[model samples]
Target: MAAPEPSSPAPDLPLLDEHRIAIDAPRDRVWAGLCRWSDTLGIGDRHPLGLLLGTQPRRGFERVELVPERVLGFAGRHRFSRYRLTFELAEITPVRTQVTARSNAEFPRLRGRAYHALVVGSGAHVVSVRRMLNSIRRESLKD
Candidate 1:
């Protein structure tokens, strides 16, 4: 079955959104892609988004957790949206890996519900992550 539509934060559980995707590639290859992508976000890298989002265009995220090819985790704060993001990657098999992206956002007090109503309904978060996973897969397949 197809995925369900994205919805507003659960009234009971605000401030979080999680998304995951599995890539059809070996762990090492996927890891290389992830590292390459993140490297391009660091200072002296060529990615536009990194320069825009980073304070000094250096390593934008804190390496909260890492375990070589098996796991990688990062935490970062966004300047424009005032949101905290956590990224997690885990190797599920020799030929597959799972990527999870979580976002912690705060909307103005008493306006969270309305903000979620507008943002969650748009499914932008899911689409972005899906594209990220696809890009990782494609990059991993490269020589």
Candidate 2:
């Protein structure tokens, strides 16, 4: 019998969305906030369409890459969108960090493409990104 093909860890995807924000918090503090916030995505995020369709916040993706307080990345499939989200943190001062969030994604079929167009490409993704940044800022400032 022939051996089966090795499974790929993640599919190579195309760039879809990217955004950045500066946080007045230390890199380590922001990193800690990010880790905690990632697990709480679905708890309070509720899109109007999502509510109409009963879409729940997705489970957190596994951290595919990590560089301590500098970089963090994750890739996964949500609904029909296969994508990656990476966070890059640069320290600008003793208590400030510039953070960038980059997203790369691929919609394999018509349904996925439509979902991305309606939800992501229509500027909702931007809102979502900003909310995420605010969450990080809030968490990082906590004692």
Could you say which candidate leads in TM-score?
A: 2
Cα lDDT tens digits, model 1, 28-99, are 888788767655433444566666655322344445445566545444433333344445667788788787
1-143, model 2: which lDDT tens digit per residue? 23223222253567666777778888889888877876765433444544444332334344576777877777655556666777888898978898888877777689887988888879898898888878877887788
TM-score of 1: 0.58
Query: After TM-score superposition, what is the CA distance of residue 33 in candidate 1 from its true location, in Å?
Result: 0.8
TM-score of each: 0.58, 0.75
Model 1 alpha-carbon drift over 4 Å, by segment: 1-15, 40-65, 78-81, 110-118
lDDT of 2: 0.70
